[model samples]
Target: MGDRQDAETFNNLLAAFGMARGKLQLPCVPALKARYVQKVIALANLLEKPLTSAQVEELETAIAQELAKGFQASQHSQLLISFQPNPKSVEQLDFKITCQIASLAEFYEAALKDNFATDSDQLDRLETSVFGKHANARVLDLLPELGDPETTTILDIGAGSGRNALPLARSGYAVDAIELADTFCQQLQQQAKTENLPLSIIQGNILDPLLRPKLNHYALAILSELLVHFRDADQARLALAKACDAVSKSGLVLFNIFLCRPDYQPTIADRQVAQVAQSFFLTPAELESVMDGLPLELVDRHSVFDYERDRLPSSAWPPSPWFINWATGRLLFDLEPPPISLQWLLCRRI
Candidate 1:
């Protein structure tokens, strides 16, 4: 059959199947319903041999029963159901899925780049896009609490694009950022120069001994989205200890890491399967244990829900449904609040 005929035939089958399965909730229009039933019957007749009315009814009943049973079986599994009232938008759904696949493809491509943009404008945009305004405000909010001194010196570890560094510098804090990516270091320097912000960028591993001596020079330090990259617990702990030592006794060492929960069976994303393998998720308790012997004290801890608004300023999209289920439903962490998945912590060196 032609494509048009095939589409009509499919719609008819869908309507009839929906009705028999008690899934159809459209308007009670006799004409529309009749047309739908006719299409379904036509398809059924094509699939099987010519059937009497009784045979058609019997087949419909059998199909409905099977569908209900399938749904019931699915309920026992950890499957999430999203209701879409209109099923006529298969093209739209296909387009959306295709776009997502394309975007992921691009992300992998960009991940392969030897250098990424970390310019001031780029950094600001990245921060605002990824974390939103509230997170930016939170960073600023925590800054003053670090206390004013002769000069505000900050060590931003994992300083991806200097998101926190630029803001801190704009606020008059002298910022020094350590990033492994040379491209990011160049971008950061350009951004600092453009804004005339006294920010310094060092291209070297934080684990390097050559960089070790310079660690104790900062008054404050931050490790936003950094700890998750470390594979060894002892290394992370040692890094935190070094951060504590870098800052003055009264200075603050602020950072955030991805906390793992019991239900967190490692996934492709967790393993960086899509991109270069780098990040490791850790349990909050495991992190606390890592910091046990360190001089840093956990002054505050909370969870940040990532919510994003569309460009049109419509409704907000909560963290991906999969993330919500993984973080909250799986009970991965001993989330102090009892249910949150992502943990944000602030610490001060004693």
Candidate 2:
């Protein structure tokens, strides 16, 4: 079948690529298999029309395994690649990669361009407007309030599009922005280069072991609009612990949590829908419980909607009382309430 042929073809191509390097015993030239690798990838792409999603995943896995093998073999043959594997360390053991959203850059970019274009103001700004005013601007406001920008360093976990980081950098603050999306990282790098911003963009999971040594160096750490994406409280807690660990004592750590409406309760169907969406909302009390022992102290909490209402048009006034009463079901005896918008929590590393 095509799946079997896909695997065999990949292995054969890898072998040929390795052999093309003249037995792989001499000095390894850079990109020795670049041409053949491209060929293999093209063949895999060609199969896309016939392969199911599962089949495509299986094919990619086989290709990755074989590619890894080719690289490993080149070492034994004394033909080194252009790079070396990183040294493993204990910090890696502390943080386990529970989830890795694949093709995150592409997915996020598409979502931002399509789904959020009308619904989100964050995506509307100059493309580099990675951070919107409601949630992100509030987080950014603390930078000037903290002290001198020259003396400060900020670590922005999930620094999508450098929205917050770029502004901070322009203000003469040092920023270390970590993002998982490759496309976003590239965009950030391009923007930094174009604007000559003092932003260091790191493209990797924030919880990577290689980043542990650099964790505690920041004076300000921001996790803007990110926690809601986690599957549950425990996973969010681990991420928070890692963020706290990366900051010095008394360093400012800021993040936002999407709070469920006070009266909201989900039915079985509602929970199923949320699971499909991969979004989990937590109450303020639930968020506090998760941060119980972390080396952080709750400093400021703001309802971003209320805090930034001035930005809206006169026509965009607060929700009508009728709608609110209806949503809360004050007219009825009992029913679950709908979700409120966003809530932010600002904490300091204790």
Candidate 3:
């Protein structure tokens, strides 16, 4: 353990753990764990001396601790990974452990079958936990660019809490909001009444046939963060087509879509998250293909982050919620194998 080779071997093991750590989600954990085990063996072989049972236990426990930390961070999408090597931690490991180390794969497998309800209360709790009440300023900034605010008739599809709808209505534009969630629809209606804003709050699915006839002739159609809920690409395309049809000839439609990494396939955890959302993450090319034959033309494509960074509080630091988001965005920008990106697509009828 005195030689530089010993130190280097430990570093390699830690680095391999880091690599496998990234792939520790439900579907890929087994394969990734195999790679992690290989690294553990490589470290043992490098020592040349046979490790005592105590040493082996210590090493495995240390790795498990780090993996647990990673698992906790992964639960929050806003977290930025801070990967500082803790080589000294191995010295602190005690051989007092009697229980078998809990498997990361087991945790993920059980999570996949989690019985959390997707009811209104669950949705409300989930939304409250992950996001704040503030609407994205980028969506608001694009409103004026679409057309004049005074006379424009804006239809907000899936307008949760009237984030964009209420603001547009308050700005003197006529706004119609369609929300499927009963609680959200009621809240939006109550807010609009309090503000005395001109808003039409329809508590129903945006695709409902009865709602379609009433949604027509809008100057601007806002579909922000809604396309991801469609069952598939074909359905997304149909939804986009419907949004286009609802707008006037001169109107524009703005929506958001998530683009997956070109090289990396989604893991089971990724699919599970998408399934819960009723969404599919597509690559930019796949999204383009979905809209290929549609009459709608892409007017502009915006990076959601570009408009959001400045809005972050200046005091964010030490991994605050906003800091984590900023750090995650920065890391992904420079990440060797890109993950996924949330992008805004602005389109107009031909």
Candidate 4:
């Protein structure tokens, strides 16, 4: 009787342990897949028998390290999809893909909730390194020239986390944001209210006519890090046209896009095609063609290279220097409609 009781207890514990180590689906990216596999193996070993609190903590640390390595690898291996030059006129470029904005909202909710598991300082560091310092400063530099303090109302399209909007509002600009992510929109609103900053936030798609009409009243429209989500050229051009229409005469549209050199072609995962997430890379000439009919003038244009010094933290793999070089180097073309590169013409509406 004693032996049987012990056996039953052991079986129950084993079952519970298995349940604790849930199956993990590997990300499609190569580096992520490798990292996830490593984590699974480590976790399996840790769950093989009962562990003290310290031992469990140690295993957790090992898992985190593996994930961080993979994240770094993924960032290093990131590449922009390449665009092939087509003889067709820019207006003729296919632009029919429609995204389900709700899907994006769901993705944001999951991402934000998961981020809470990370340390605040670590998150801040990651944000600064990956997003805040490098690219945003370039965008912020143009704000002074993009609008006048008293006269202009600014529209920040694709205003994720309200990063740009928050600063603009604090600077006393009349700012409004259009964000597609539900959780991000909520967070933005909460932050704005908490900071006592004045900014209007609209949670909706840029393609929605009724919801986006608010954009037409603005003097300056900013589309930072937004255009790359466009999978089709026609769709992107239409969005651009709508943005142009939203601005008043002599109004400015400041935007940036990720483009690949003609020699480099992106794999399916790089373009997010496998997941049906929309994305596209633009060629220099192709971008210019899209801006032909817009009433805006070119102000200045240059290609900004985005380079990363470190790797991403979410990936579970080892870092590869060659992959990092390829992923971190990006050609950012800043344009004002009636197109140019880096910075473009400042055309006055006729």
Candidate 5:
């Protein structure tokens, strides 16, 4: 920030605030609704010099109190917000806060790092993290649908650390694993090599147009626990299009997606908020709209939690501590029946 011009930095901050609140979904968060959007202060005008440590804290408090007004009603929870600075540049912040309210800026800051990019340190923590802590219960249960591992080929897009892919390969199914994070790819590669599994690791983003896999080549494509990471329903749409392109005719695509209730109309801001909380959500209608013209047919959709719960033994009620919270939409809300939930969806190519 020291290197950036003040004006540029200020503009960026303003944009971040606007984005965090969301222009399209502002109504969902009443405090940040129409009038508030027009009233956000230009902090630049208030401060001519750099902020002192104490001043920053004061600002954060004041801001959090305001954001809390909306946050309390905005469906956000008091989950641990994490941050990891670059090992070289910024000093690491080793701190945690528990409070009645958290500012939108705090969430915005956290969202910036939530993406497990090449530079992010999340890869080192994925194993300890609840994500991919266990092979997706739905993916494991639905494996037989792919049929004849000896001859079937499977594509696991966004395959983090080979959670599902490794198990499939070990079962003798030829697997192609695509991942966006370098460390995750390397982790999967090392494990695959150790067992000499038939899994091929590809380091790429499924969203990249140039990262094309063979068209109509795979018997099945598994995208379990991945779509919610996409920026919006549109990005999910693109990935599904790619999945449709990769699976052969009559082949299938199975994905675990977080979806809002059909009757629930989430504002764009609501979706943005969901993403910041480590979940990206879409409506069933939006999903149908995505696969509308594709050569894909929706075969079935089941509640992920219900399927896994009814199958896994009582002792293994939740595969991980965060599994129930995340899979049932508690990550975004504390409701008994969260308006959103994870769903196991399967589609077949025409």
Candidate 6:
């Protein structure tokens, strides 16, 4: 009980759990995962001494990061992981890592099985909750971006559960919702059908050209809260080109994304955790290079939180519980403020 444990001790626990550094992506349910915690506790008991609160907290973060990595490995496409710090239950061993997977697994698995039906669920300790109630405050400002909603067409890429697309449709905009998840697509579809809104649900990756039947058909393309999941600048470049290609000449492409501030270089650990949390970012220069040859021209940039928060009434408030923190880059890393922050970009098609 005298020795304070560290990452070395934690590494030993991971070995005992059969989740070695390279093989942490094993899938299991919460009860089973809870059992893994007990097993690791037993191993820690047999070998290492009781850990200090600081040590336990450090281990908890490591576990959260590792779990996020495993989760990122589990996804078919890029998945935003919400790595929370709170232990699922801290009573048993005073350590937290293995138990953290329970929340993420249950949530993502249910959504994957089309069972996520409530308004929203916390994606992680950071409150990276998905399936929020309100449309983005910024997305609601479409009227000024392009005139006459009835005459203009907008594409909402990665349109999760009609958050933005549905509102746009309700406001009488002819909107095409491009969504990847079947559950989100179904939700948007049913909602649109029920309301008889001018929203069409197109299911698939936004990178696919086939998804867009006609070239330059949309007056605006919005990739809200999407670009962060992209791996690097290459993916961003391609996705931007596609978004630009989908819009008419001089049309607009509106995307909100995290870009690294000057002189802030993310380490390998930071990058991995970001990918796990779906908070991937490119440097502003990298972004500029990516946009160099593309038809899209950056016309405007705004601080996401400041721009949206200032515009919304106090009653509208956050737009969603997760919107404020997530927009400001508070939830991307584990308790550490990321060097990157979100920006609202409005680009015109050249």
Task: Kindly report which residue pairs in candidate 5 clash with one another.
Answer: 25-269
lDDT tens digits by residue: candidate 1, 215-324: 46777788865765565577688778878888887778877655665554544333332112233456657776898879888888755334112221222233223334
Best by the lDDT measure: 5
How far is 90's C-alpha from truth in model 2 (Å)? 64
Candidate 5 stretches with Cα past 4 Å from truth are 1-134, 313-317
The RMSD (Cα, Å) of candidate 1 is 14.4
Q: What is the TM-score of each candidate against the true structure?
A: 0.53, 0.57, 0.56, 0.55, 0.65, 0.68
Ranking by TM-score: 6, 5, 2, 3, 4, 1
> In terms of lDDT, which candidate is stronger, 1 or 4?
1
On residues 155-274, what C-alpha lDDT tens digit does candidate 4 reach at each position? Answer: 888887665787788887778888887656776787778878768888888866566545357777778767755655676677777778777777777776655455544454455322
lDDT of 1: 0.53
Could you tell me which residue pairs clash in candidate 3?
none
TM-score of 5: 0.65
How displaced is residue 58 in candidate 2, in Å?
25
- Weakest ten-residue segment in model 5 by summed lDDT: 19-28
Cα lDDT of all candidates, in order? 0.53, 0.56, 0.57, 0.52, 0.68, 0.65
Q: TM-score for candidate 4, please give it.
A: 0.55
Expressed as tens digits, the lDDT of each residue in 1-350 for candidate 3 is 45766656676555345421111122212213334444554544453323456666665565455444543333211112112223554322222211122232233223323532245455433323223345555566666666777777888887865657866888889888887765566667777787888888877666555666343588778887676555457767767777888888867888877677677676755543453332346766778888988778888876555545566344321212542333233322345433666567888877
Least accurate stretch of 10 residues (summed lDDT) in model 4?
91-100
User: Candidate 3, residue 286: CA error in Å?
Assistant: 2.3
Model 4 lDDT, full chain set: 0.52
Candidate 2: pairs in clash: 215-246, 216-246
Better of 4 and 6 by TM-score: 6
Question: TM-score: which candidate is best?
Answer: 6
| Whole-model lDDT, model 2 | 0.56
- Evaluated at residue 321, the lDDT of candidate 5 is 65
The RMSD of every model to the true structure, in order and in angstroms, is 14.4, 16.7, 12.0, 16.4, 13.4, 10.5
